[model samples]
Target chain A: MLRRAASILAISALVLLVAGMGISAQADVIVIGEIAALTGPTAQQGLQERNGAVLAVEEINAAGGVLGKQIKLITYDFKGQPAEGVSVYRKLVQQDKAVVIVGTNFSNVNLAMAPVAEQLKVPVLSNAMEPAVTTPEPGKVNKYHFLAQPSSIEQGAIVARYALDELKFKTAACLVNKGNSFATSQAEAFRDYFNANGGKVLDYIEVPAGAVDFKAQLTKIKASNPDCIYIPQYAQEAGLQVKQARELGITAVVLGANTLGVPPFVEAAGSNAIVAGTYFINNVHFGDPRLADFMARYEKRYGEPVITTNVFFGYDNVYIIKAAIEKAGVAEPEAIRTALENTKDVKILQGAGTITLDPNTHRPVDMPAWIFKWEADGTTVPMTLMYP
Target chain B: MLFQQIVNGISVGSMYALLAVGFSLVYNILGIANFSHGAMIALGAFFSYWIARYLAVPVPVAILASIAFTGLSSALVELVTLRILRKRGQGSLYFFIASLTVFNLVTAVLVYISRGNIVSYPRAFLSGTFTIGNLYIPWIDAGMLLISIVCLAVLSYVMFKTRFGLAVRAASFSIKAAQLMGMDIDAIIQGVFFVSGTLAGVTGALLGVKYAVYPYIGNFVYMALFACVVGGLGNLTGAVLGGLLIGLLETLVSAYISSAISPALTFAFLVVILLLRPQGLAGRATEEKI
Candidate 1:
């Protein structure tokens, strides 16, 4: 009886302590929640995104934060799962009481959380590149969801146009991963654009997800003798495809989405010589003079060079949120949603210096994608920025 | 294109063969499928990667060292899981579950260590392709085929021509009878695990060289399992044949039919073959061991 009473007393004390801490946490701060794939296959990208968000929050607080209050960023790990993204969104909105949420460059994760964001009535500034993340349908928009980058369709169309008009590739072949929506969406856009604009699509091969080998498909593609092969796969898969294509003596110019420009793609391809001359769409040109300060600060803070373009997404998402809250003139979810919808000419560190979300689609308007070529020495040479 | 696709199939087949032979060795002796072979495959890749990266050793030396390490790890797994279960007189089902748990645990541990980042070997090791007329064969693929043949040859010689081979075969025939005849069943099981582990280790290292190294490379175990199943489960030659056949079928289906549905087509072919011959291509009609 005495032991039971003592246990009850301990449990009550713990509850009181938790409640007190919760109340204290709500004081003098605007809570902003972030969901990222912190501990899964894409953890590196997620962590980079988190780091970028943290850096922006620190900078904002250092400069006497928005609306006379410091922003308290609460980050949750979605672990690269879509279902976890929904739960995390609910927790952030209902439990944490965050006025705005920033996060996740993964299109699927952002897509999963879009409906929940609408239900919860909190504005989510996402870095995901899927068009459907914001505008789920042609005419309808998810009011609370906003994208910080150009959609995958835009990226694909831009690459296709650049290949046809700039490189003068008359015939093209597309290698797509059927299981990944990101790859499929990009590949479809590229194919449609390329076909509609004089260039003939020789072979359109779709491989399953987790397929490491591409020799047989490349051999078939080689038979067609296309001028260029557009492979819109993730980094590792794209790396393997390019390497295998070169091995099969398919010397046609290789084109890919942004994933091919990352370190993993180079690493997976095994050598610079193998990947040399491959063209890929990029989010940011790493050698851009304007990005020098941000890169230096990131390297200084993280003790490593900025690895991927996700840093820009994370950094820009926080700044976008801050701009929204400031524009709203009140630190409420509904007001922030309105301000984000009307977001125009906000300065952030990606694509042509400023972001203006097309309130209709909730995606940035006239956003340009940078095209980069892999040099023989493994360094990426930024060629030109193509606007959609 | 047909010839090139065939070459591609054979190249991929050789990889599946390497993994299948290892998996078959364990199933031959113990009717249970030891899923921990998957963990050993992953460990083999990571071990070689760690050695080459941190010790800064040459690639060949690192591979050899990792092979030995993985062999010991396989034996350790046997000691901790299978041997304990055997002593307890438990069913193979328990070992199956335990082996799967080990596979997941090791992969999770690797995910933590590598931070889920896919990494390649620090230095170039067989990192280029060579062409033959219109045929483009990567040095890594050729190397893997040669290595697979040599490993199979050596394994065959050991299994058919050695005293240890006699003991192992005796145990497979009947573990109780073998023990009654004074054969060390425990030692034989440990030996089989070690050999299988070495095969897994070599496969992992070569796979890392072929593709980039990542934690989930153990997913290759599924192909290995498929190879073993399609081959006579206990038949070594059947395993190789099944591996090559599956590789050829996958390549051909993708080349001629549809890359999108190639996996489904390949599995459907497997189902047809199994329905036609339940004993597998090389397996003889016999009573179920388990």
Candidate 2:
């Protein structure tokens, strides 16, 4: 009778174990697809966006994941190409069945991915700061679309203010790449403010990108005798201009957009001659004493100091996702989106910077743009803290 | 002041001549464009950058190694991408397509391997400014000019004086014919690729050391393409002249008209030349020889 009772207990335990395993398997992990120009021209930008997303996901998982299950972030390569970005987004939605997506660092690529996201009704958190991403028809845009970064208009206006108030330049020359959204928007903002502020407009030079040299623009800038030259271009082309300008003895403040803060621009331009300052709406400021802990953890993992906001963006993004998941209290997309929208003051990377959401703007609450200058020793130093 | 722009043109032109000559040699000898030529260029720079970052070699030694690495990579390309596909019945179309795919794959593989970080040379290589007259010559530009002349002179001597070089010339003319004569055809062909690849590598290294190295940077070789076109595709002398001329043209455009139209000027020149004289600057047309 004891032997029979023991056998019954063992079989019952086995059944119970199997049933528990079956129930756990039923709670499926929701796939979150991320597409970025992980490689190609403008690669650094893509890298930052991808890094930010990756870090966010990791933090999300570390903080008990989303819903009762862990998120599966499926990343795809679009190589900064519009068509490729579209295809990648489609694949993520149709084949991968990713509940939500974020991607495409380039404005054009982001715009391309927008239609696909709208058609599929998948909430897309675009990292592209292009003005068009928010306003599709200049006024009409999708309600579900969200952007982590502020618009190019804000970036342009901030830069314009810096050039006028801070730099105190009389005449400024503008080197605008006629092809890109960042260049065009910044150029517009600079024009509106600089001229209105009683500064002489030297020359509005439109340079076609990848044209090898910028001697003509330099010559024009030289002739105009501008106190400064505003370049709303990335580091690759921007480096060439700064180098060429200095080469021609045209000593003027060469200002650039936030993209200029990257290492390639500094390396390309060299140190002493080409001085540049840029604004970034980053969550983590390098000078933040609160970031000391985050930095320690980051350095411990990567074996290097996190100087730029690139790594911080990734690290904080992870926490943002974590907060959203916690708010949702479930892994469901609708619940997660609500949680993300409701996320406020949930600090992970920096002990500061509240992640507040306003229903009117449909972006994070009161993003701050900080200025950083490349130091003599090849280190990016925090210059000014700003709210835009 | 205008003189300064001209000098700038010459410096950049030298770089193109450096790149175009190697490309022209590969095209002439192999009877194939060797589209993966960019890989050799990039690798040369990659090697130089690595040397600067890790070993901290002087620029001169780095240049030499860049050439050798590029040459070896070129030979490797032939081994992996060309040799198997080469057949009597088959033309260069097979090699061309295979290598185009090879080019894309190599680029993809390189990027995947590096995770697309911009690998740059140490700043010490090209930091100071050397002033000659009113013109301020940057150390980097000065270094590029010196390197170009040294490589070009050495290449000339090798091609004219050395027996290995003669074999190379023979192989390029007609591989079968050269084989029929007393010559090791395979060795000659391999040597051509190696030599040509080395030249491209040197150019790439120079570019990386002086400027910066991200992935696929060789695509920005503006002067090389124009030089190739102007030099009649496979002519060495023509390549040099073409590179220098285009370099000057670009500088002039940048100095006077607009820097934005410099690339457009190159294409416009190509179109005009093609329409008027498709045979090229020094390219011969032998239709109905008397």
Candidate 3:
């Protein structure tokens, strides 16, 4: 009798929960889906991305949200897995009824989601740097997928050119993380550009993923004596590499992707003194006068200073969706995707001036990358903006 | 460059040795791989970090305190899980699975506590490198080598010279026989766990200093397991030799050959070694005791 009564209560509670969810899914609000690595190795960046998106949504709704409706964000943790990303994408689109999806700076995850986005017909605006995320083959594009930042090819070539032309580096070594598509794509581009353009690449070393020790590899690189080292790894590995390189007395100028500017890199390196003077290609110029307000607002909201360029990626992604919705003149997935394809001069944070996605490839065209030098005090000084 | 790589290998090998010895200790007694040693390693790191950060203790003092704490935690784990299983006359297979589950649970709890964020020590413990000739050796690596040697020496002294060590050895030879001879079986097992946990704590605290502190730092236990297998499952000296060999092989392979395939090549080499000597490098073939 007691068990029967408990079962009835449990059934009624579940019914009430479902009913509550149904009521919250109002027609008055436009639902947007976001996928991020919210609870895994990359959770730090994912949380920053989520926070940025939430902040943008809050501000957008305050100014009377797009298409005469308030914005509703439904975020799911991808847990840094590509398969999980696909399932979450499906859940958000099919169950949550989202008009657009934003997120995930991880290239592999975005690559996995590209085909699913095409089939679902829901536009995805991502910060993943790999060009293959949007364009699977040369001259072929995934119409539903869009990239916010410049692709890996462009960023890689830009850094290579900066090293060769501006820094006058005659020799370089490339240390790549073989498992990460983001790192490999950049390293390949850098190597191709550097070798073709009067710079000799001494050695190209590929390390396994999640490796902490680089002393042996660094020892080999030291023998070759390169003018600079191009390390295209995530923040953790990059930090360790730089630290180990410095310890081994390899004083070559270390260059890396945007991950170098994050707090994790500095923390992993152990000391600012170790990372000082290292150059990196960054997405956002933190020193920009324009970003001052956003920085202040972010710190106030999160109770911590902005750690990575992911914050801007997350913030701009929501605004990009808002622009698409406003351009399409409707809160619908198909309409928003088409509008996103034709997106032009949308005023958003990150990069210079405004964002414009090329209709042909669905990637930002002629997006310039910011080059910064790490300071001894653990801050980055903006040096120059390079265009590829 | 070859000499420098060798130095690097030895430094790396010493770290593996520290972890492998701890793993070997539990295996020596129970004959079941105590995978919870991994959890103790992670706990050692986290406990030291918390003590140093929140309690504002000196890093050395914090490490020492964490070692004791982890030791007690390991004994408590045995008291709860292995002790009860022994009482029920359960097989070692159940204990093995229970240990792996404990490792996962601890890692998950740590992940929740840390929010999956990788953190460094609050202050620099052993920062910077001092070069001997053209070969650069970081103070942390040198310090770790010294500490590892001291730990092993102390462990050896305890294992061979002490009364408890006699009991442990006798138990390892035959637990049933040791019990018949009026030895306290449970106490010996608990003691072994405490000692193993202490070794894990030392390795964890040092590893956190060398690298960064993260919940997944416990993954180093895989290397420990590998070292134990290569060194001869029940032999202490073999565990140490196996660790050094693996480290040296990894370093030399990465330095001379391809870095990407180094792990594959190292494991392949290990497989070849195993095939040649089925009893392992230091292990002697013995009849299975029923």
Which candidate's TM-score is highest?
Answer: 1
The global C-alpha lDDT for each of the candidates, from Candidate 1 onward, is 0.90, 0.70, 0.91
Compose the digit string of candidate 1's lDDT tens values, residues A108-174: 8888999888888999998777788888889999999998888889999999999999999999999
Candidate 2 lDDT tens digits, A1-388: 9999999999999998997886466458767778766676556556655565665676667776666577777888897578998898888877677767765546777777777666777766665667666567655665556666556666666666766777777788888887777677777887777888877668887787655456655665676688878887876777766766777677776777776766667666656335544332333566678667666766675566664555654455555665666677765556666666666776645324566655444466666676666555665676666555
DockQ of 1: 0.80
The global Cα lDDT (0 to 1) of model 3 is 0.91
Report the Cα lDDT for candidate 1: 0.90
- Go through the candidates in order and give each one's DockQ: 0.80, 0.38, 0.80
Per-model TM-score, in order, reads: 0.97, 0.84, 0.96
User: Stretches of candidate 1 above 4 Å error?
Assistant: A1-17, B288-290
Tell me what TM-score chain B of candidate 2 gets against the true chain B: 0.91
- From the highest lDDT down, the ranking of the candidates is 3, 1, 2
Worst 10 residues of 3 chain A by lDDT: A19-28
TM-score of chain A of 2: 0.83
Tell me the lDDT of model 1 at A278.
Answer: 95
True contacts kept of each: 0.83, 0.31, 0.74
Flag the better candidate by DockQ, 1 or 2. 1
Clashes of each: 0, 6, 0
